[model samples]
Target chain A: MSSFRVVLGFELKEYFRSKGFMITTFLIAIIAVVGLSIPRFIDLGFNRSEEGSSSREFVTDNSRVIIYDRMGYLPPDELLQAYSNFQYAGSEKEVEEAVSEGSADKGFVITGPTSFKSYIYNADMFADEGAQIGRLLSYGKARKYASENNIDFEQFKQTLNPEISSESVILGKDTRGNYWYCYALVIIIFMMIIMYGQMIATSVTSEKSNRSVEVLVTTTNPNSLLFGKVIAGAIASLFQMSVILCAAVLTYRVNREAWGGLLDMFLNIPLRVLGIFLLFGLFGYLFYAFIYGAIGALVSRTEDISRSASGVMMVIMVVYFATLFQLSNPDGIVIKVLSFLPISSYSAMFARVALGTVTLVEVIVSFAVLLISVFLAGFLAAKIYRMGTLRYGNPIKLGVALKTIRRAKKQAKKLAKEQAKEGIETANEDREER
Target chain B: MLLEVKDLVKSFGDTEVLHGISFSAESGTALGLLGRNGAGKTTTIRILMDVFRADSGEITLDGNPFSAGDHWIGYLPEERGLYPKKKVCEQMVYLARLRGIHKTKAMENVDYWLDRLEISEYKNEKLEKLSKGNQQKVQLAATLVANPEIVILDEPFSGLDPVNAQLLKDVLNEMIAEGKIVIFSSHQMPLVEEFCDDIVILNHGDVVVSGRLKDIKKEYGENRLILSSDNYSMPELRKVLESQMSDIVKIDKEKKNFFVLEQKPKVTRERILGRLLNSSVKIEKFGVFEPSLSDIFVAKAGDEYE
Candidate 1:
């Protein structure tokens, strides 16, 4: 047990001291700080736009509108009621001169009873309050026509537009916003596995190529060495993730009001759902860590690390892509089946649960499968590691490595049994002599 | 006996690397594991250290079963290395701690070994920064950091200069004095001759010549004689040696000025000396020659050693 601790301690020290680890952690921290502060910057920009719109509202409300009744189809009091804070102009030329002199924000010239043209400082204003005034006058004309024809005004308005509303309900208390956070977490897990898993493999291969493993194995159990390295890699990755997560949470907390309901949605993920994320996150990492360690052991040189780890990398890719595809169709039969698979369950089942498309029993079952697979992978990896550490030169295939491990284990057991039997025979002979 | 390996049989795939090889060493002595290249010396040492399983073997320590990990056995493999990027003192402490030494004790041991190896200045230096000879010394220090009871070294003197090699020799001597079982394999015959009390010469995974170094040398009878004279020219010495000897098994004088004659079976050293004197060869030096370990190795391994 102390040997185990020693291995773990030194491996972690090596990891922390490595340049790659430090550089990657620093890069992630920078990205996290930058990622978290983006929303605040965006909110500032948003508030600036809101302030600009509010000032525009004050200008449009207080500014005057002048009317030139050239056709004489408009009455003065009704026109005044139609356009508040209006000034009567003597001619169209006067209205234009007032607009040019900036006395009015807009000008109205009554060409006929139902048609008019306006002079404005900007074309964008034409679509603004001017368009609203046109619609309102048109409605007034329609209502007058309806009243004269003995038609119901309310019925006429209802004919133009009808009332409609929409609402959605899932099986459980989950929002579309929850899916966003779940998916982000899944992507985080994927990226971490790739970064740290490769680190573990590279580290093991470095030790092998450096020939330090020869001395290391003689001092401690090879299994302990493998586990120590894998766990150390895991801890290092988790530490980086936690740093980034804390940065994100801190940034969000400082600007909670600006983030609004989106931040609340992420923060309000049920405790149960968070529990599932933790379970699958930890177990899934362990599973991949074991496989990566085994691959590292099978390869003799650091140059072969990537090529050897690619097979396991491909498996992880499959799981990640399946989870991504399943997120789109959480209720599909294929996705439901994949959710139960140990390989895909880590992300797939978690996504389903986050989307409120899975039951409690399914989560429990899938989690069990994932946990069991982690243990089995750890077992096989330890065996391959023990057998592979001593065998050097060229990368070995997994099949051949497993076979060699089994053979070596059998041979060791036989040797032990023979030694035990010889011991018993010697003891019996001594008894007979006595 | 502190350690014994009896009839160890090891095979890799279908090829038998060691067939029933056995050797034992007691405390307070160094056992020289001698062999030509690919003579199963490493295989034997690896089995003794339990790096690999022997197909058939029973090793005992103090008349009980022995397991490598369960014992305080220090090993320096033929392919020696330390973590090149790791600090020397840190690596030593880590390895020592793995061997179950307390942290404080391990650090003390590391400091002592670094000082002993005259590498205290390199305690904080990365291994790659050191010269090759210094790196080798650091490896040696790491091997002894745990203060193991039995030290197995494979080719410990391979890459060392004379000074460093002598340093290691002195350390091996100290280990033996402390009642540690020291077994090491080396091709440097003179070093083995200098320090080894017993020797095991393996040939093709078989122990062809083994036992106490002096006893093995004695077993190869001293039948050869060298005659040196200050006055004798090459031709005159040849004539004198030819006339004075009968049943001369072999004569090799063209190689040098002195006459080295291997007498026939049952020939006594005194008889050869008397014959040379009776002929008045005016001998300046006369001695019976004992075969060196290399000669015995060549004789035993034959063309393989050649």
Candidate 2:
């Protein structure tokens, strides 16, 4: 326990003092803030300039229909006045000129008392406010005709507004937004584990190459040292990630209006989903940290660190790409199997839960598998570490190292038993003599 | 015996490196663990430090199982290493703390050792920035910062100039004065002769010769006799010594009519002096010289010493 504390304190001190650590945290915070603020800043810039200078634009805000009396059929001023926010023009050329000069949003020419030709910016006439006005005017004409024919306006209005109600239900999946939110969380967790796992490996390799492990191992248990270093790395990474996450949330909060309901994407996520993300993320990092440290110990020099770490990286990559591919097919058989795999489960199982296609039992079983696997990895890595650190030369293959570790353990056990037997024999002889 | 190693065996893969090596060192004495390359001196020290496990062996300290943590065994491996980028005092404090010293005490010890080594000014300086000799002093300081009960130094004098070597020698003498079991390994034979009270000579992973330094020299007996004469040409003295002493194996000429006669069976210094006086070769200085640790090491281990 004291050795653990010593190694932990030393590792933390080194990590905290490192310029790389400080700079990376600061840079990540900056990036997060910038990522959240850029869209809001752009929106503010557009809103401020456009809103301040455009009263005429506001005139067009409510359809600003320029009606050209081409047929001279609209001589009724009261009728035009009753239709609020409608612009009227005398000649077709005048309305055409107004529409062409961008002063009006749309224009119209009344060919007859009940019909008219409409002008719009694009073919999406339903989207144009002026087109709505044209439709409303045509409806009014028909309503007027109906009144003259003694028809009920209430029933006609009721025809325009229906009372039917309907609801949407996805059979076995969550909302699309929640699915994407879960996927985003999974990707972040995956990247974090990979990045920090590499850091742990590199740190261990540096210690070994520097030959500090010799002094360290002699003074303390290698297993305790390994655990302490791994924990330190995990804590450091989580601290940095939290800082960046907080920065992002703060930036979004400050520009809440500009986010335009983007926060809702995350807010709607169930708190339990976030809890699962955290749980799986922690176990995943622990699992990879042990493997990385063990691999790091196998190497004799700094140059071999990356090569030694490549195997672990490959496993991580497989999990990552497979998870990504399963994102679209979250309920597929491939993902179902992948969710049970200790490595991929951190991502795949959480994703399945987020998609609302996974059961609690599945999550518990997967999490249990991962937790047990992490403990086993830590144990095996420590064994490998104890053996690998003392042997220096070419990088030891993992197979060879494991075999040596097994033999060493057996030898240690045999030695212990013999020592115990010897102690017992000596005790028996002494007792008899007495 | 403060530290006793018995029949330690170590093997790597199919081959055995250390073949039943055994030795012991007492408190307040410096044991020179002498060996050539691949002589298993390092392997043995590593096992003692508990960096590597021996295949089979028993090490006891004061009749108790000598664990790695039995005492703060200060070790300076032949492959001298430290965090080159770390400050001198910081790494020293860290290492001292690893040996179970408290933080504040570790800091104080670091300061004391740095000051004693005359490197207080470079306490906060990165080890890489220090001169090679000063760096060596810092390494030595690190090794002694914990005030270890048993200290193992392998080739501690390597890469050091004569002045720095003397500085290290003085520090080691201080360790001996403190009653520390200092196990030193070095290729500089004269330095070993000066530092070691007990000697273990390893040849090809085997303990070829080991005992109290004085006893080993005595048991081997004084095989080389040196004679410095005033009036005698080289040919004349050679003829006189050769004709009388048939046991003389080799005669090496030194400067100013000095000659060293290697004898198979020990010859009394007085008898040689009588013969020289009878031959009219007036002796200026005559003494039976005990073989040096290096000579003994070479004679026992053969021509493998580099």
Candidate 3:
């Protein structure tokens, strides 16, 4: 424990004083804040109106009627205000000109048969609703005129809305804003575990390379030294990721009404994922920390740490990407398999739990696998650590390490055989003397 | 004994390395562990520090075997270790703190050591930025700062140019005076002579020679002697002494006008001189010579040091 404290203080001091660590922490916080802000911005419905900059829709030619129909939800006064915001264009050239000249956010042109049902938009311009408006107005007017002239208007008018309905039903209990809220919870946990695991591995490799492990191990046991590195690295990750998460939540709170459902989701669930996150985080930490510590010992230098850890890291990266792929296609065989894997389960289960698709049995199975792996990894790691502590300079060959363990077992067997033979010989001699 | 080792044996795989080695060192005495390359000097140190478990040997300190998580042994491995990026004081205090010293006390020890080592200005300097000698000094200070009961240093003089060697020698001398049970290994034979009271030299994983430096030199004194005469045939005298002391090791030779010899218990040096005088031999420059530890080491461990 004293050694662990020594190394812990050593590691924390180094990291805290490092320019790279400070810069990285700052950068990660920025990226997370930006990423979170983007989703909340999506939730805000793009209203720059908080700055009192009202959004407007522009129309030209006969396209005004289509614009009016598409935008008919506003009252007449609001519609008049839309006209003030709008600057009409007579031709395609004029529409482009208006958009280019900052007179319009979007531009449209209308040209068609008398029924008038075509829309054209410049690639650079926003969506065109002019042709849609023209069609609506012409058809609305023509139908009204036809009905007044005692002609049948049944075919003249078509339905304004399409006939389509879709619904999502969550299988388990949920607090709402359902899918997105669940996804956010899942992504955060998945990112944290994987990111922090690599941090632990990288830190171990670096310390080993510096021969810093020698000084550290002298004061602390293998477990505590490794534990501190893993824990400290995780704390750094959590700090970075939390800054981002908080920024996003604050953004949502500011635009509370616009993101009312999201707000409700936050308040209702209070990120139920947080509890599971903390639990799985601790569990997975010990699990991955062991793998890192073992792989770290196998390499003679820091450069080799990356290569030595490559096999496991590749598996982890693949699992991470696979979990991401399974997000949109949950319940696929691959996703199901991932949810069962100890390494992949953190990501997969978080994704499912966020999506409200996990069950109690599945969670239990995941935890069991995680717990078992942590124990086994720790055991194997401790052995490797004990052997590797004094084993220096040369890289530890997998074969040699395996052979050492085998040789130990062989020596035991050989000793036992010798003892047995000696016992038998002594017994025979005793009988002969008698 | 403060530290004891009995029949310690260690092997790597199928190869038996250290075979039933035994030695003990009491507190307040520095022991020089001498060995050639791959001689198990390092292996013994490792076993003693509990870095490697012995195959069959037993080591007990203060009447008890090693206990798990007992943080008492202080080791300075041949390979230097200091967090290059950390400040000297920072790393020193942390190391001191680990050995059960309070943070404040750790800092106080650091300050005193920094001043004692004459690099107090470097207390805040990064280890990497310091001169190599200064770094070595810090490492030395680190080993003793913990006030460990047993301290093991391997090639402690490595990387030290001559001046640093003197500084390190002084520090070691100080440590010895302070009653640290320091077990240090060095290839420099003369150094082993200067510092160690007891030494065990190993060759090929076995103890080839061990004990007090003076006693070994005294044991080699069995046949060595000096002689002078009034007048005698130099050739005849050489022939006679060579025939007489043939069993004793020859150190050097010139002519028998006056020659050195190892006096057998029965042959008194005065009696030999009187006999030479009676035989009409001229006597000059006759005195017994004792070997220095370095000379003795070279004499016994021979040729391999080159």
Best by DockQ: 1
| DockQ metric, candidate 3 | 0.35
Q: B14-102 in candidate 2: lDDT tens per residue?
A: 89999999999999999999888889989999989887788887788986778876677888876677898899988998888777899
The window of 10 residues in a row where model 1 chain A has the poorest summed lDDT is A53-62
Candidate with best lDDT: 1
Q: Residue A161 in model 2: shift from native, Å?
A: 8.0
lDDT of 3 by residue, B37-106 (tens): 8888888887776666667656666756644247465678766777787789888888788778888888
TM-score per candidate, chains pooled: 0.82, 0.81, 0.76
Q: What is candidate 1's CA lDDT for residue A121?
A: 69
Kindly report the TM-score of the first chain in candidate 1.
Answer: 0.70
What does candidate 3's lDDT look like per residue over A90-113, in tens digits?
A: 556666555566556555343432
- By lDDT, the candidates rank as 1, 2, 3
lDDT of 1 by residue, B1-306 (tens): 568889999999899999999888999999999888999999898888777889998888988888888878889998787789889999999999998899999999999999999999999999999999899889999999999999999999988999989989999999999989999999999988888998999989999887899988877746666667877886887776676565543574343566666777777777776666777678887777666787677778766433
State the lDDT at B233 in candidate 1.
87
Model 3's CAPRI class is acceptable
Docking class of 2: medium
Off by over 4 Å in 3: A28-45, A48-177, A255-270, A325-337, A356-365, A375-379, A390-434, B13-16, B62-71, B161-179, B226-268, B271-284, B303-306
Instruction: Report candidate 2's interface RMSD in Å.
Output: 1.6
Task: Give residue B60's error in model 2 in angstroms.
Answer: 1.8
Which ranges in model 2 have alpha carbons more than 4 Å from their true place? A44-175, A327-333, A357-362, A390-393, A414-434, B247-257, B262-272, B280-282, B304-306
